[model samples]
Target: MMTAERHFLADDVPDRVRVGVADLAVATGETRVTTSGLGSCVGVAVADPESGVAGLAHVMLPDATGDDRGKPAKSVEAGVERLLAELEAAGGDPERAEAKLAGGSKMFDFSGVSEGVGERNVERTRTALGERDVPIVAEDVGGDYGRSVELIPETWTLTVTSTHKGAEEL
Candidate 1:
C-alpha cells in the first residue's frame, strides 16, 4: 500500500501500484492497483480477463464538466473514459471489459441532506459505465464509513477494506 494512512513493516507484503486520490491506472497481470481514504469517493476497477489487462480509478467527484484542472481521474465520467482508453492502450479490449466498483461511502453526516455524495458517486459511475456499454459485474458501495481498495488484475479481484467492516473481495 502507498498511502499515508497505512504502512506495512513486513517485507513479505507485496508492493502495490498505488493510484492516489483523483487518479487512475491500467496494469497487466502480476500488478495490483490500490487507493486509500475513500470518503465519498469511488474505486472503479475494470478487467479484460482474456487480454490479461485491468484498470483502476479513484474518482472523487461525479463529473468534471468544462475543466478537470489537469486531473483526469477526479470525476467518475472522465475516470471511466480514461480508464477504458488506458486499458485499451495496454492491449485490453474495451468491448470485453467487465467492471467492479467499491467505496463511495458517506463518511460524514449532515442534517436534512436529501442525498449523499457517496450515492451520487455510485450513480455517476454506473451511468458512465452504462453509457460506454460496459457491464458492472460486482459492487460494494453505500454506507456511513470510509474504505480503501486494491484491484488485483492477476486474479480479477477487488479487495475492499473498511475499518468498520471486514475486508471482502468483489
Candidate 2:
C-alpha cells in the first residue's frame, strides 16, 4: 500500500496576498493574495485592465507630513504613486489604470483619534487618486468593521470582505 503525502510550499500558493494597514501590494499575475485586520486603515487596489497588472495598498494615514518626512510614503498619496509607478513599469497603460479603494473602518470604541484616522485616510485616498487622474471604478470605505481585500489581476476585479457583514463585490 502506498500513502499519499504532499506539502505545498509558499511558491505553490496561487497569486494570493495578505496586506496590512498602511501597506501595499503590486504584481502581474502568478499570485492571488488577501489582507486582513484593517481597522481605521484604508486599502487601495490599482490595476490596468488591459495588461492584467494590479496592485494593492493598506494605508493608515493620509499624507506623511507631521513628523513623517524621512520615512517612506506609506500615506495615501505616496503609496498610490508608488503603485502606479510599478504598474507603468510593467507596461500597464497609465490612462487605462483603474483604482479600487477599500477598508477605512472605525474599529475602536469612542476614541476620537482612532475614528478620525479612518475618515482622513478615506479622504486622502480620494484626493490622491483625483490628483493623479486615476479613475476609481469601485470603493468600500467608512464602516464599523475591518475589511479584507482581494485583487485578481487577470479579471481586474477587487473583492472586499468584512468580518460582521457579508462579502461585497467592488
Candidate 3:
C-alpha cells in the first residue's frame, strides 16, 4: 500500500508554494507556484502580468471520462478550465493573460500502449486552452525527460527544470 507523499516548503521559503500531482495552485504578488517530477503529466500555467495573478495546474490525464467527481485539476479539459477561472477570480484579466506549458515527456515505452500519454496530454492541453481563447506564449513540452516547473506571477515568467537539461526560463 503506497501512499502519496505531501511535501511542504521550508519555513523560510515565504511565498513559494508547491503543487502536487493532480493539483493546482493560484497566487498573486511575488509568490511562486511550483510542481515537480512531471513525466507524462503536463504543467499548465496562466498569468496576468498587470494584475499580478497567476495559476499553475499539474494535469495527469488527457481527459476525464464519465464522472470525475468534483476535482477538475486531474484532467486536461477540466484542469485548464478550472485554472483559467481561478486566475480570473484572483484578479487576472483573461484578455491580457498569457499561458506557459511544460512537461509531457515520453518517459517510458510501454509494450501495448497505442499512443504515448505525453503526446496525448500535450495535444489535449493545447485544445483546451485554444477553445478558451487563451494563447500559449511559451512551452517546453514533448521530450524524453521529466521536468519540474515554477511560475512567478509578478514577472510573468515560467522556469522549467530537468535533471538532465538544467533550467530554462520562458
Candidate 4:
C-alpha cells in the first residue's frame, strides 16, 4: 500500500487556499488564496481593501459556447462575473473594488492558430471586468511561460510568481 505524502506549510507562511483551474475562491481577513501553473489560462483577482474581501478566478477559456452546466468559473466571461458577485456579497463595494490579472501566456506556436487562446483569454477578461466597471490596477500578462498567483485579502495585495521571472507584487 502506498501512502500519500503530507506537505506542511512553514511557520512564517500564511495559510493558503488554492483555487484550481476553472475554479474561483473568495476570502476575507488573513487567509490567502492561490492558483498555480497558469499557462494559456488566466488568473483574475479582485479585492476591496476596506472590507478585507478578495476573490480569485482561474479562467481556462475566453467564453463559454453554451452553458457550463452551472459552473461559471470555467470561462473568463462567467468567471470574472462570478468573482465580482461573490466579492460584493462578502461586503465588498463594487466602486471600491480593484483588479489584478496574470497569466495568459502564449505557451505554443501553432502555424495558423491566429490569435492564441492566451491572448483571447486576456482580452475577454478585460472586457468582462470593464463591463462590470471594475478598474484593473495591475497586470502581469502576455509571456511565454506559466505563472502562479497568490492573493492576500488582508493587504489586498496580489503576488505573481513565475519560474523564469521570480515573484512580484501587483
Using lDDT as the measure, the top candidate is 4
Quote each prediction's TM-score: 0.86, 0.82, 0.87, 0.87
Q: Give candidate 4's whole-model lDDT.
A: 0.82
For residue 71, model 4's alpha carbon misses the true position, in angstroms, by: 3.3
Ten contiguous residues minimizing lDDT sum, candidate 4 = 1-10
Instruction: Give lDDT for model 3.
Output: 0.81
For model 2, how does the per-residue alpha-carbon lDDT over 53-72 read when each residue is reduced to its tens digit?
A: 77777766776756533322
lDDT per residue, candidate 4, 32-117, as tens digits? 88899899899999988887888888998897867665455788887887887778776688788889999999998885654599
Q: Runs in model 4 with CA error above 4 Å?
A: 1-14, 112-115
Per-residue accuracy of model 1 over 1-170 as CA lDDT, tens digit each: 23212222223334567888877877766676788888889999998889777878889888676776666688888889888888887778999999999888877777554348788999999999999999999998988888898887778989999888889988
Each prediction's Cα lDDT score? 0.81, 0.70, 0.81, 0.82
Residue 160 lDDT, candidate 2, scale 0-100: 84
Residue 77's C-alpha lDDT in candidate 1? 85
Tens-digit per-residue lDDT, 103-164, candidate 3: 89998887566358889999999999888888999999998999999888778889999987
Q: Where does candidate 1 stray beyond 4 Å?
A: 1-15, 111-115
Model 2 misplacement above 4 A = 1-14, 65-73
